[model samples]
Target chain A: MFMAPPATDIAPRDPLLPRIVRLRGKRREIRGVWSLEVVAEEGEPLDFAPGQFSMLTAFGVGEVPVSVSGRTRDGIGLVYTIRAVGAVTAALCGLRTGAPLGLRGPFGAGWPLEEAAAREVTVIAGGLGLAPLRPAIEAVLAAGGRLVLLYGARGPSEILYPADLARWQSARRAQVEVTVDHAGPEWHGHVGVVTRLVPRARFDPDTALALVCGPEIMMRFAVSSLREAGLSDARIFLSMERNMKCAVGFCGHCQFGPHFVCRDGPVLGYDRLAPLLRIEEL
Target chain B: MEIHDLEEVLRGHPFFEGLEPQLARLVRGCARLQRFDPGQRLFREGEPAEHFYVLRRGRVALELSVPGHETLVFQTVDAGEIVGIAALVPPYRSLYDARAVARTVVIAIEARCIRDKCETDPRLGYELMKRLVPVLFQRLRATRLQLLDVYGAPGD
Candidate 1:
């Protein structure tokens, strides 16, 4: 069990504090029902493994945890697909380029990308679940490993990073497939839940690690779908979504069984989430 | 959708059964419909306030954790019952997690939106309070019973 540190020894950054070097929101756009990408200001360099998340603070409103979209030496992209139902998100929508914003950290234990080096990788994204897995896609591409991506969204408009999608399709380094919950007249892509896209990919579960993110219901379905496709619980991984106040595990808000979403993971193997995930509630 | 049409949809709900049409419409205007499959989480404990939902179809399980990390199902909501009223109170975070046991449909109204509208119209707010208070106390009573079960003989 992890214990909280002494308050004096660890003067954690106050999100509400007026720090001179502040991050600003470049723009906010609705990619789907509750998903938006906020390009934040460059403060300190963000060094995080793929699948870690940061807490976004909008002054006088409140703070929310969003996935670290990507990072380059120049700056990092903080992509948050917010369900615009609350005060912070409602205010977050109103923010523009150069508006003040607070950032806590790129916290949480990320996916074990290093542990699965030189292996076949299968990444599955359900609905807006793609937001957290974008970094891993970038990492896999950078490493030149054999990879496959299966993306599922509500529909065409709900699909994120279309330009990136196009680039991946053209480069053809990794096989990519997309599906939708409901299709419009323009959509000719696969029409079904993201789980359906898994069977189309060619991979050996023994040689591949599957990473999935999205709504808990969708993730549950995706895991079962992958297993049905011959993947085992040990080879499947998932990123969890829960309320986190202190991005660092100081608060118990993110606790799920023996693990905390902020500490042990926002990303964890199925071995952890499977049993708890099987529970009808929680 | 027109606010009035929204009210009619929720008026039949036991949670809002006695609410005036205008107030019911206000609730409806603030609501968004959500659909989830069986065994899906509706919300988790300690999550920041967002919306309160009324089940239209299916059932939702309310769960609380024990000392050993074992979760106990306190109750389940059938059609016409409300969930997430904790959003109406201050600090606006869930005290327990709720999940779906079947393909569920819910009318979720943003708590902030309803609260703001209520602040502007105290009469409507007063009526909502009248409805919610008893439900809150009843839940507390139910939780008390659950605690008794936990502390009582091995199989109660």
Candidate 2:
């Protein structure tokens, strides 16, 4: 029989355990950041909505919260288009194919995928924000809803996940518009913030749900733009970002007013967060 | 810069005052910069007490979980404050998780390093103890306020 270790001997090990299995993907260059389509190493199906996120940990370094980008049959794939900011992210940037990393949770509340099951859906992703909204778009298409995706980036160089986006657009025959802040020599698309594309799309917001994610500045503009486009606060949803350590509610790090972003959000309707959303600093 | 630069940033902090310059520098050396966006966690309950942190900017909320009930938010740590010092003492492990409520910056110092340095130099350790006691008292007071928030009658 194997002997058990003493309680004191195992003291102080990291408390968090990886709930979602992480799989390695062949890194592909997408705009300025590297894109990795991470699938579940364990084959557990990820049933998440548009704006839910997972906490990806590079052991011995740290963990970060990322949006789930794609939901496929083999396993749920996460498209990580990360900016090399901190120690953990910097270390993640150096990882190559077949490199192992830890995955924990499809944590936080996702877009109301279940609630919006039958409604028309509009998803707006600005810059790297596309990483999280990808799953929502996929879910809409799978559910056979009329879905439109509006993607905006700083320029041609910052667009993320070309192959996946192209496949979804062509296969589903969904409307996907690509906009840029500045166009390069080879670029031929609308040039402006993502909000500019709102006018071109046709979605009856009163009966539709609009999900938006991007930089805080962009999200603010997007929300207001949707409202201006006659979308009610309750009909529009926005994904909020903050540094989340524990994807669980146990950590108070991701609190906005009385809500925990890691638990209550990553996705919140404009009606719920509208008051705090106006508070510029928070 | 030396420890005084750290002290200036943490001016009015009770945990480092009256320390000898040399010893103060040793404590400061262990600290590093940390930053967080709105709605991020610094640590969680039941996690190892690895490092104690001092807030430089932003807000941190401390939350405690109670069985069969909603988790209670105990307190908020604002800018220019020190937290997680108790984790530096014996039986180190966080009692509650510390999290950032807004875009926050902090200085985190490894408690083990400070503990080792304190063991090697008792005199400096004594100064640290004196400075740290009042902070502990303040935490206790804040925790009491939280208890009232949790248990007191809604209108009371």
Model 1 agreement with the true structure over A1-282: per-residue lDDT tens digits: 999976694577674343322333333334313333444344444466788887777789988887766653355445555555567866665666566667667788887788655777899886556767877888777778677899876556667777777787765568988765543323434544565566568898778989888767667767877887888898898998889888777778888888888888898999777788767657
Binned by DockQ into CAPRI classes (incorrect, acceptable, medium, high), candidate 2 is incorrect
Candidate 1 to truth, TM: 0.58
lDDT of 1 at A144: 80
> TM-score, chain B only, every model?
0.86, 0.80
Task: Write one digit per residue (lDDT tens) for candidate 1, span B77-102.
Answer: 66776888889999999988877767
Clashing pairs in 1: A34-A82, A35-A81, A36-A81
Tens digits of lDDT, candidate 2, B17-110: 4556677677777777788887678888888888988877776766666787655454555665677865677688888877676788887888
- Candidates in order, interface RMSD in Å: 19.1, 22.1
Q: Fill in the DockQ of model 2.
A: 0.01
Where in model 2 is the C-alpha error above 4 Å? A1-15, A19-23, A37-50, A76-79, A171-173, B1-156
- Deviation in Å, model 2, residue B92 alpha carbon: 74
What is the C-alpha lDDT profile of model 2 across A1-282, one tens digit per residue? Answer: 999876684454243686444546645465225655566665545555557777777768988887776654365466666666568876776677666777767677888887666888888888778878877777788888878788876556667777767876785537787766543323334444566577657788788888888776667767866887899988888889876888788878888888888888888888999899768777
Best-matching candidate per TM-score: 1
True-vs-predicted CA distance for residue A173, candidate 2, Å: 5.7
